[model samples]
Target chain A: MFVTLWRMITFGFQNFFRNIWLSLITVLIVVLNLFLMSLVSGLNVVGQQTLTAVRQKVDLSVYFIPTTSEQRVDQIRQELLRKPEVQSIRLITRAEHLQELKKSAVDKGLVDAAIDALGDNPLGAGLVITSKTLDGYGAIANTLKDPKYQSIIEDTGNNFQTNQTVISRLSLIVNRVQVATLWLTLLFAVIAILMVFNTIRVAIYSQREEIGIMKLVGASDAFVRGPFVITSLLYGLVASILVTAVLVPILSLTNPFFAQFFAGYDINVLGYVREHLWTILGLEVAVGCGLSVISSLFAIGRYLRV
Target chain B: MVTFEHVTKTYQRRNVGLEDVSVNIEAGEFVSIVGQSGSGKTTFAKLIIAEEKADKGHITIGGWNITHIKHHEIPTLRRQIGVVFQDFKLLPKKTLFENVAFALEVAGERATRIKSVVPQVLKIVGLEQKMDRYPDQVSGGEQQRVVIARALVHRPKLLVADEPTGNLDSINAQEIIALLKKINEFGTTVVLVTHNREIVNMLHKRVITLDHGHVIADQQAGKYLL
Candidate 1:
């Protein structure tokens, strides 16, 4: 058994090196397939991060009547905190609102005119509420419309509606991209499988006479089929190594571009790839070896009838 | 020993490969099967090695009925009976040494055993000096010699040669026949399938003549009478 296994391994290497061009082509196809798979995964991570950043920027401000008590405002803040959708909330006093308006005024003359014209702080106190998700904003808006707080609330800011539109549009784009990437990846997977199958078929076809001779000389099915199967596995192993070697440097070089594009969103593509290197390589090995083995099995089956 | 009890083999279009043929050869005998093209000589060799199934009867080699040999058992059967073909089916990418060692290698022989046996067989075929040469580098007769060496590596109890000299000239053909005769003298049963009357007449051994998939004559000390 050891002798048989050794012969299989040596013969497999012999076959692989003997057909160098074919092996290269097979490995190239596997690399392309793996690279596309990693690209899709990377895109998904970035998309999720961008969506989270957009969701964080969306908030609803509830303005209260100036006569509303601080205790009532504190109650509303506590109630919002109890809800899972509300990520955070902060109180804005009437004085703070006026100070913000005054700071935003381009000229001191306009600010003074506004303060003198009003004769007092006309701004109302409010609570600024940030939600965990895009849908959470709508949930908070519904909660604010309750009759118990109707008299105390003056108006809800328009930021929620504008941000909702942005969130919905981003969701549509992301969903479409996900679907398209999935289909493209699947299509490339099919092509890669067929290419492996055909390459193996041609390799076996060239060795058909040798296969017959082996059987005639008392070679078992395993003996005749082992070399081809081993050769295919080598192709997968080498291709995985090549893909990793190529991907790491390429990702590193492109890191700055991706980092700059997602500057404030904090989507670190390079970091994600670095953290998941093993997982990515593992996936590539599984796919590369799996496809080659299946293809070799099918190709070798036809000539083993002898 | 080999036995064929009313063996019949037919093909997809109802073409007869062998038709109700029955023959037997005892141990340590040199037997020749001669026929024209499509006369079932090759099919007879195939059946002995369990390459084709007997359609209507039984075949036994050394008392083992291989009429319906299992797929996996074919290898074991083949190892016990070395087979040689006319085309000299040598792997082109392998050297003569690798070609001869391949038979034993497939049988799971250790490298030490292969090293010892391959050189001995190549020496018998007078190609030990040229063992490192690839098949394409050798002459036709040398290639056939390599095939014979490969077949001999197993030291099989029976050797089946199906027109092994068909592609060679008269001189090379005689050399191959002489080699087969030498192997038979060593007590291995030899079954030579051919249409070459000169070699068969020269053998002066038992000959089975076939015509249209049926045996026409079976004679000890037979010449190619057909």
Candidate 2:
């Protein structure tokens, strides 16, 4: 049995090299198949990361008129903080608010001159409120509309308005893209699988006479099929390695671009791949080997009757 | 060594391969099956090796009933019977040595034994010098010789040569027939299926003549009667 198995693998490699062009074509097909799949998978991961980051950055701020006393503002902060849904409430005092705007201003001289002209800070103090979820923000919005705090809180729906709109639109776009890509990936996978299957079928059909001769020479079905399976396995392994080699450099090159787009978010796809190297390779190999091997088996089956 | 009783086979539905053929080839006999094209000469050889299952009836080879031989068992049956085709059927990519050794390798023969045996078999067909050459690198006769070498590796009890000389010139055909005769002399049953009138007349062996899927004549020490 060991001898037979060893011969099968040896013959498989022998045959693979024999038809160099065909072997190369098959391997490239496998690489293309895997590359497309991994590319879409990486895109999905990045999309999810961007969406989550945007959602986390969405916060509601309740500004008080400059006349509201510190005690009154702190009281409203404490009251909002007591709500279980509110994750955090930080007080942005008028002085602190002025300092923030001035630091962020592109023209520091203009901002300093304006501050001197005003003499007293005109910026309003507010409580920046965050929630565990986007839905929790809705509850917080309702909580602020209570009649008791109406005197101190100037606007309930003012600060989070544009961000809420931006986030909802962004979420919609990302979700649509994810759905489309998932479908596109599935469609591409099916087409590629069929193409591989047909390629193998053609290869086997060309060798149909050889298969018949092998059987007549007393080779069992396993003996004949063993070599083909090994050849396909090599195709899968080589393609997976090539895809990884291709993907690592590609994702690495794209890292800078992704970082610029999703600023402060972890968009390092290469890092993601390395972190899940085993799973990624495992899945790639499984798909590659699984696809080619199955294709080869089905293709060679028609000729094994002898 | 081979028995066919009321065997019938057809292709699709209309094309008949063999029709109610009943024949028994004794052990160690040199029998030539002669017929024109589409006369079921190849079908007789295919039946013995279980390459094609009969649509009806029974077949036995060396006392084993193979009328309905299971697909898996076909290999074991074929290993015991050598078959040579007119096309040579050598793997084009494989060298002469690899081609001959393939038979044994598929049978799970050890590498050491294969290394020793393949050359001996190739030597029998006077192809030992060209053993490393691929099939396409050699002449048609040499390729057919390699097929004969492969068939001989198992020391099979029955050797079926279906149009082994069909692609060969007179000289090469004579050489292949001579080789088959030599193999038969070594106590292996040789079933030569061909349409060569001159070769058949020369063999003067037991001949089964087929026509349109039916056996029209069986002659002991037969000449090319067709």
Candidate 3:
């Protein structure tokens, strides 16, 4: 039985070389399928990273009027920080806020206008409140609206209004992308299944007579299917190599552009690939070969009726 | 050693491939089934291999009743009964040697057995020199000989040739018939199904003539009587 299995594997190898074009064509199809899937998968990785970084930069600020005393503002900051949902709150004084705006200003004209307006710094001390997740930032914003903290607000709490809108919009976009990626992966998976089915169907058609002859010569169904399964395995192996070769360099080159948004974040898709090297290759081979084997066996069993 | 008792094969409940066919052949005997295209000669061969099961009957081969043979056991029965079709059925991509070796490969014959058996069979069929040549490289007669070599790999007790020479010329047909006779002399039961009346008459073996799914004649030392 070992000898038979060895011969079957070797025969499959030889037959693959014998029909090089067909094997190559099938492998090419597999590569295209995997390439598209990997591209979508890689894009999803970048999308999540970008979304997280953007959300991290966003926070609601509760500012007091410039006339409000520093002792009261400090007390309000302490009270906000004590809330369970508030992960962190930073007290930004009027001078610090003015300096931050001036440092980040892209235009010198805006800085001059800000200093000249009202003959003094109109910017007020505020507390920049951040939550653990962007989704819960709105709740923290609503908590600041309580009648107890009404004195903490300056200018009817308009400071957090714009930030709240941005966070909600970002959250909606992220949710939509998640749904789209889910459906897209599902769609591609279906296409991959169909391609595997048709590929195996055509392969069986080519081997139809040979299958009958093998059966006539006393070859069991397992014996007949072993070669095709091995053939598909070779196809999967080649496809995985091709996809890896193409994806590694492309990801390495593009990850830096996306990393600029999030400090200390590296778009090292190659690193991810390296970390999961065997697993990724194994998954590709398993999916590609497993699909072909299942579809071919099913088709042969139904149509060949052997 | 094969017998078909009241075997009937109906396809789609309309076409009769084989109808209540009853026949028997003892061990080491040579039999020719002569018939027109649709006379069920091929179907009879298929029935023996259990490719087409009889609608109703007890069909036995070499003492095993195979009328209701399971799918898994069919291959074992097929291995015992070597069959050669008119199409040559040789893998086009493989050489004459590999084509012959495929049978041994499928049956898991040892390298020692394959190396020893393949060359010997090729020599018997006069294809020893052309073993390295592909099917396209060989003549029709040589291709048929390679297929014959393949059929003989198992050293089967029963050999069924369904128009083994249909694609070959008269000279090739004569060579094939001679080879069949030679194989029969080695104690293999040969069942030759053909329409070649000349080869049939020349064999002077037991002949079973069929017309429209009915066996009209079964003669020892039979001739082409149609």
Candidate 4:
């Protein structure tokens, strides 16, 4: 059996070299499939990171009136920190709030002049609230609504609800990104599969005489069909290496652009690929082998009825 | 030895391939099946090799009934019978040596055995010197000889030559016929299927003449009497 398998694999290579150009085209198509998948995956990771970064920025600020003492605000901050729902809360003094307002995305100089015109620190002290989980804001909202702290806590009508909406929207975008990657991968898979099927069909036609000779020589179906499977394997093997060779440099070049686009976030696509190189290669080879083998089998089936 | 009893084969389009064909050949016989195109000569050869199912008949090779041969069992039957096609059916990409070795390879023969056997067959076909040449790189006669070499690697009990010399020149055709005679002399049953009148008459062997999917004549020490 080993001998036969080895011979079949040799025959598969012989057949492969005959139509080197055609086989190269098949390898390219597989490479394109893998390339698209990797790019999409990398982009999806960056997209999720960006969305998470934005969601992390979504904090419900509880403003206490300027009359509330710094000690009292610290007490409220300590109490909120004790709750399981509250991840962390930073107490912002009136002066710190004014500084933050001056540094907002708007015209910083205009904001400073307006703050200076106020003649005193008019901004109220507040606690920037963060929840431990994405949906934990509801419980934090309930905690803030406690009767004891109600008078001190500013009546920010439904800030938790608004933050939840933003969070849910970001979650939706993340989900959409995931779904889009899946669809794009599937679409490329379908295209690659069709190319494999068509290429194998042509290969089968060219090798019909060889197949006939093989059959006449009393080759079992496995022996006759084994070469095509081997050919697909060769395609996958070669394409996998080529894709890696091409993709690594490509990811390296594109990493800078990605990092710049998602400025504050770390989008090292090349790093991710390097970390998972073997896994990516393994999955690619598996997918590539499966695609070509199944496609060749389908194309060669009806013709091998003899 | 091969036998066909009341074999009837019809195509899906209702074209008759063979009708009520019944014949038998004893061991070590050189039988030439002669007919014009579409006269079931190829069909007769196909049945012997189990390449085509006998729609309604009992077909056997050396007493093994293969009329209803299963799809998976075809390779086994074919291994025992070497078939030489008129087209030679040599893989164009493979060298003559590899072509011959491929036959043995299919049977899962070991490298040592294949190395030992392939050269001997190529020598028998007088192609040992040109064994490395691809089919397109060789003359038609040499290619046909390569096909014969490939067939002989199995040491098949029965050798079926379906128009084996049809693509050759007169001299090459005669050489192929001479080679088949030589193989038959070694106690192998030979079934030569052809329309070439000269080959059949030269053979002066057992002749089975087919016409319109029926055997109209079967003569001992016969000529091409179509």
Q: i-RMS values of the candidates, in order?
A: 1.0, 0.7, 1.4, 1.1
Better of 2 and 3 by TM-score: 2
Model 4 lDDT, residue A117, Cα? 91
Which portions of model 3 miss their true places by more than 4 Å?
A64-98, A105-125, A153-156, A252-282
Evaluated with DockQ, which candidate comes out highest?
2
lDDT of 2 by residue, A36-56 (tens): 778777777777777677767
lDDT of 1 by residue, A1-306 (tens): 887898999998988887788788777876776676666656666766776666666677788887887678988999989999898999998888778778898896888897899797777788989987666777787788788877688864465466567666765775676677667767766776777677667767878988888888889999989998898899888988888888889989999998888787767877877898899888878887887888889888878888
Tens digit per residue, CA lDDT, model 3, A2-118: 998998798779768888988888778888887877777666776676666666677777777787777888888787778777778888888997888888899968787868976
Which one wins on lDDT? 2
Q: Cα miss at B71, model 3 (Å)?
A: 0.3
Question: Per-residue lDDT for B47-105 in model 1, tens only?
Answer: 99888898899899999999888999999999889788899999887889999999888
What lDDT score belongs to each candidate, Candidate 1 first? 0.86, 0.86, 0.83, 0.83
Q: How big is the RMSD of model 4?
A: 3.4
For residue B6, give model 2's deviation from the true position in Å.
1.3
- TM-score, predicted candidate 4 vs. hidden true structure: 0.89
RMSD of 3: 3.4
| C-alpha TM-score for every candidate | 0.90, 0.90, 0.89, 0.89
Over the true interface, candidate 2 deviates by an RMSD, in Å, of 0.7
List residue ranges in candidate 4 displaced over 4 A. Answer: A66-125, A131-139, A158-182
